[model samples]
Target: MTKLEQIERSIAALCPKELKAFAKWFEAFQADLWDMQIEADGQGRQT
Candidate 1:
């Protein structure tokens, strides 16, 4: 199976606590990605 499919299966098996932690981490990761996008935009780079 592909890596993305593997991750999807793993996520489906997470317990409540684990899912909460994963969601929190994903939120921070997305925020960091957005920050980088904004920084790139400020530098006039096409995202």
Candidate 2:
């Protein structure tokens, strides 16, 4: 299976507390990714 699929499976088994923590972490991770993409765009880097 793909790495993403494997991660999905792992996430599916998280306890409520773990899930909440993961959710928080994911939000920050996505935000950072978007910030980097925007900075790259501003610098004229091809995505």
Candidate 3:
């Protein structure tokens, strides 16, 4: 499994009930970081 999937599986096995919250936060964090990276790339290309 991918690292992310492995982590999720581990967490799920340990705390099934909290998986939803973990997923939500993980998605938000990944999306925000991706947006930042894209924005940075745009800035870099413009410079």
Give one clash count per candidate, in the order shown: 0, 0, 0
| Candidate 3 or 1, higher lDDT | 1
- What's the lDDT for residue 38 in model 1? 96
Q: Tell how far residue 43 is off in model 3, in angstroms.
A: 0.2
Worst 10 residues of 2 by lDDT: 38-47
Better of 1 and 3 by TM-score: 1
lDDT of each: 0.98, 0.96, 0.81
Q: What is the descending lDDT order?
A: 1, 2, 3
lDDT of 2 by residue, 1-47 (tens): 99999999999999999999999999999999999999999999956
State the TM-score for model 2. 0.85
**By TM-score: ranked, best first:** 1, 2, 3
Model 1, span 1-47: residue lDDT tens: 99999999999999999999999999999999999999999999967
C-alpha TM-scores of all predictions: 0.92, 0.85, 0.61
